[model samples]
Target: MANVNDKYAIRMMKADDYEQAFVLWNGLEGLGLSEADSPERIARFLQRNEGLSFVCEYEGSLIGTIMAGHDSRRGFLYHLGVATAHRGQGIAPLLVNEALSALLREGIDKCHLFVMEHNEAGQRFWSANGWEKRDGILLYSRGLESRGLE
Candidate 1:
């Protein structure tokens, strides 16, 4: 909740928020967005993880966002970003706290997030916020072809 006199508010993110959130994320450095972030995909994500994602609004404009979801065991967070002008105003953490709190309410006990190897600022932010970095863990990925495994 924002103070009555403040110009900012925090709330759960809705599907309609995708456009604004995409613009904010695309403009931010160290954020790696791809086709996976398409509007349809984001909308689907919000539906599957309802009430777990959040956004921050300031003066009627979106200034921050955090997307969260879970696999019935561990929660994962993504796309956390704050407008450049809104940095240092504690908006990022507020968005994060909102997502984390929602995850907790869903009975998620542990959480994880990824930072690009080159994103120094992002790494620092997570470290400063009490998130531990896991060492010796490798992440692997594979892309499925449209007609594979038929």
Candidate 2:
């Protein structure tokens, strides 16, 4: 765990955090937001994943967030973001560690996260923090027509 000052507190992310977390992620340049990020969806995710997501707050305002979940095999992380003013304060790593720790507790050993192809800063951050950039694999996605809440 990274040592954060008394002014900052890290805790499990709850449904009530959606509004502030959405604003924080929207202000960030590289995070992709979609209908999957709607309040109802996020609330459901939090309910499904339970303790896997986390947030860092400075004096009661959220400044960082990381969401993690597993498919009963490998874990995946999403939407790791720290406020611009708090970028260099180790908040991001702290959030990542918290999520990873939670995943570990749930018996998940391996984890993955996607960084946008153009997000050099995000790439650098992940690499510098000991995450490997995998080769010889490609991500394929197909969007199905929305039924109701998907």
Candidate 3:
């Protein structure tokens, strides 16, 4: 699992890693989701999605993670986060690049992710990484309490 960096390793996450990944994931203010995380919710999220997750380990500790999933038409990104302590160490882009490469390899030519309008820093990071922003596209969602969905 060691790379040339020697201090960091990147690989697919396993079931056992979910606990650490959960703590690392929740500490970040990404994904624009409303509900708080619990092990049960994390497990349910994994059940409903089919994709790959890559975790970045530095010095044997989990530092960052990214997940990629695709519907028939396009690839979507979710829950990309780097622990506060891991920021500025070139870990974020590494996680992102790995997910992007995986999507391309899976026959996905187009990929998209949702960033809250208020999350300027996250938007900047995506733009700086060469991901295009599409104008005039609006997102709508129905919560579990929504009439029809439930």
Candidate 4:
């Protein structure tokens, strides 16, 4: 697939694109992908929050992706990535805006995303896009079974 003009098309991330998307995620540094990021889980997410996640394709190849979903309380973003060759081409913001638009259509106003401290590249990407890093904030997690939140 040769998109010599650096133009890419954005679309909803379908189950069929999981393999390509997963490979793209693996190639990017500092994305905390896990077993929960498997094809089945992603399919379930897209099913539950239709139109809230997107992938950018260049000449039929998945080159960028952003995952967004809301629990009717707050929206969360995850695993946004752009191929190295396409980094400076403004693909990431396009993908993000698409997802944010979908979330807003659902009446969501506040959205949040997690970025690793050491991920300077990812941090810069978010910062450049107008995201603020909140001080005095920390995140904690645990298995549902362990926490009885299941």
TM-score of each: 0.95, 0.93, 0.81, 0.91
Clashing pairs in 3: none
1 or 2, greater by TM-score: 1
Q: Which ten residues in a row have the lowest lDDT in candidate 1?
A: 1-10
The Cα local distance difference test for each model comes to: 0.91, 0.93, 0.74, 0.87
lDDT of 3 by residue, 1-150 (tens): 324277878887655677888778667775454463566665665555534567888888888878777785798887788888768878878887787787788788888987877878899999998988999988876666656764
- Candidate 2 deviant stretches above 4 angstroms: 1-3, 146-150
lDDT of 1 by residue, 27-64 (tens): 99999999899999999999999999998898889888
For model 4, residues 12-99, the per-residue Cα lDDT tens digits are 8888889999999999998888879988999999899888889889888999999999999889999899999988888888888888
Pairs that clash in candidate 2:
none
Q: Name the candidate, 1 or 4, with the larger TM-score value.
A: 1
TM-score leader: 1
Superior by TM-score: candidate 1 or candidate 3: 1
Q: Write one digit per residue (lDDT tens) for candidate 2, span 4-59.
A: 89888889999999999999999998898989999999999999999999999999
Winning candidate number (lDDT):
2
Candidate 4 — which pairs collide? none
- List candidate 3 stretches off by more than 4 Å: 1-4, 30-41, 44-51, 144-150
Clashes of 4: 0
Q: What's the CA RMSD for each of the models?
A: 1.5, 2.5, 2.7, 3.0
